[model samples]
Target: MTPSAEILAFMGRLGHDFARPEFLVRALTHGSIASATRPDNQRLEFLGDRVLGLVMAEALFHADTQASEGQLAPRYNALVKGETCAALARQIGLGEVLKLGRSEMLSGGRRKEALLADGMEAVIAAVYLDAGFETARRVVLNLWRDRLDTIEDDPRDPKTALQEWAQANGMKPPAYEQTGRGGPDHAPVFHITVRLDNGETAAAQGSGTKRSIEQAAARTLLERLEGRE
Candidate 1:
């Protein structure tokens, strides 16, 4: 089937022409709108996640020959995390082309991080299937060019780093608590506070998820403890 002008335009932004337009269509379909005759992007999202991982791992492996696995692991995670995928999707206006159910649309699904991230992965899978691994790799590399170039040498997760710092200083493991929550149920904001045994603490708020807020709080506290902030 011929792709609509909208899909074609999205393809232009994605830098890929679909040999099988149906794949792109399937990738954009959300579970909320799926039916017996229409499949959701969940399966495609799963496949795309692996494809993205492989592409990122290979790229990171070649980008820094001297970097050890311990260093590369965090960098890879930073590059391919759900937040990064969602950011990429927003950059390319992928949310504009998402085919969501009425309920999802009413709930502002297009702007949702999880939904956008899942869609990004599905699109990657679609590209991998439509062309080949080489083409998919090229597309991914192009999309992530800026990030790949400027990725930190030690982009460790804040929680892990904070835990290590606490342990090294002879302090007990840090504790995190939810101080408050606000906003609508569909997209609530989480307020998290991280505190060490020594009474040092930091608080952060985010709509990305409780875990993300916790990470942010940890980062804040860690930076303060290390005199970086």
Candidate 2:
């Protein structure tokens, strides 16, 4: 069968004319719907993850001549994390093309961060296989252009920073608790609280996921303590 118009349009946005379009189809296939004839994107996701890491590592190494390994590590993590990949997938309308089973579709799998991130990585691997490493690198670098340009010098996650602070002060790491949840199952809001060993606490809400909500709470707590938020 020929590629659908929507898939072709997605390719236009992706900026690669696939030599083997089957790869793109496989890349968009989710595990929830996989079958003997139609394999899922899991393997592609794994390859794409490594591909993304290598490209980002090389880019960071060249982008900042003065940055130490410690400084570059956080920046690399910030760029290549699943959340960021999912955001990029959304930007390119990847979720719209994801093939999922009925259950996953009902559960809003298309909009899931993990699924989107995995799909993004799979697509990267598809590009690599369709053409070559340089082509994949080009796509990754182009897709990550804005993020690469704007990444902070020290881009550690707030949760990681908070834990470091706690450990340095002879305190246990902060604890995160889900205080409440609201909204529909497809799009839920989570309330999380992060409490330090000293009993200092911060609470925040996020519309993404439990992990994101917890991170938001940690960020809020860290900002408050440091007078940055």
Pick by lDDT: which candidate is best? Answer: 1
Off by over 4 Å in 2: none
Question: How would you encode candidate 2's per-residue C-alpha lDDT over 1-229 as one tens digit per residue?
Answer: 4889999999998989897899999999998999999999999999999999999999999999999998999999999999999999999999999999999999889899999999999999999999999999999999999999999988899999999988988999899998899988988888889999899999988689788888888888888888943
Candidate number of the best TM-score = 2
Query: Could you estimate the TM-score for every candidate?
Result: 0.93, 0.97
Stretches off by above 4 angstroms in model 1 are none
Query: What lDDT does candidate 2 reach at residue 6?
Result: 90
Clashing pairs in 2: none
The candidate 1 region of ten consecutive residues with least summed lDDT is: 220-229
